[model samples]
Target: MRIFNEFTFEAAHHLPHIFPDGHINTRLHGHSFRVRVTLEGKPDGKTGLISDLGTVKAAFDSAHEKLDHRYLNEVDGLETPTLENISMWLWRHFARSLSGLAQVGVYRDTCGEGCEYAGEYEIERKAA
Candidate 1:
């Protein structure tokens, strides 16, 4: 069975390397970032559910609190704070607590600009 949850947070960031030539991103900016977490595993026979929705929500809420209404560039490990990096950071944050964590999708907004991270193995392969 596979279960998914969605979360949203607002944060400010600036990509200094994206467009250094007087681009708008060079200055501080904010976005309503959305994230989706997917978990894959066999449902427990007793509960018939992959996981409890409230439990998952609590986990996401705890993590999102760190990002919400904050400056992404000031967050540790988020100095660059691109969509890709943010997704990866989220994956790492939840992997240990969420069993069978499969993927994390991070979006800048509703316009479909975002990135998805599968796991550390896949990320390592891409780097290689």
Candidate 2:
């Protein structure tokens, strides 16, 4: 079975070193970010659930608090804050606690752009 949870956050960021001086990403801007965290596992016979929504949502609380209505560039490990980077950052955060984590999806809804990180790869790599 697979389960997922999502949350949104508002933040501003500038890709200074990541982009050229004349590029638009070098200019500070804000975005409404939508994130989805997916997990996969076999349902437990007693619980009949792979995992509960509460646990998934609880996993998002700390991440949401850190990113919401803030400057992403100021956040540790998020200085660049591109879609790909943001997804990886989230994967790292949630992977610490959620063993079933499968993937992390980060989207800039306004721009219709997004990225998904393979959480399982990181999990397996770490175990190895």
Candidate 3:
């Protein structure tokens, strides 16, 4: 079984090389970023839930603390903060705290663009 939840945060960023428009590429912009984290696991023998919502909320809360109100480019690993890179970063962070994660989607409303990464916490299949 699988369960999922979404969380939102705000961050500012700009693409350094996308264009020299001065306003779009140079000026800082913010977005009401959205993240969807999906988890999969067998229900606990007694609880009958894959994982409690509170447990999952911890991961989301932690992520918000790190990303919210900070400049994306200023973050440790986000030199550019493109949608694809942001999605990958979210996957890396949240995947460790959950048993199974199906996907992570990140949206940058400023540019009207977003990216999604699937199979983030899925078990790797070995070659036969």
Residue 46, candidate 3: Cα error in Å is 3.7
TM-score of 3: 0.79
Task: Evaluate residue 89 in candidate 2 and report its C-alpha lDDT on the 0 to 100 scale.
Answer: 88
Clashes per candidate (backbone, < 3 Å): 0, 0, 0
lDDT of each: 0.84, 0.86, 0.79
Instruction: Score candidate 1 by lDDT.
Output: 0.84
How well is each residue in 1-128 modelled by candidate 2, as lDDT tens digits? Answer: 68888899999999888676999989988999899999999998999989887998998999999999999988997766778778888999998989789989999888989999985443222221
TM-score of each: 0.88, 0.89, 0.79
lDDT of 2: 0.86
lDDT of 1 by residue, 1-128 (tens): 67999989998889987787789889988899888999899999998988886777887987788899999998887777888888888888898788888889898766569888898543432331
User: Per-residue lDDT for 1-128 in model 3, tens only?
Assistant: 87888888988888976667775767788788988787877889997988777777898888888899999998986777877778887888887887777778887666677787874333343454
Could you give me the TM-score of model 2 versus the true structure?
Answer: 0.89
True-structure lDDT of candidate 3: 0.79
After superposition, candidate 3 runs with Cα above 4 Å error: 20-23, 108-112, 119-128
Ranking by lDDT: 2, 1, 3
Best model number under lDDT: 2
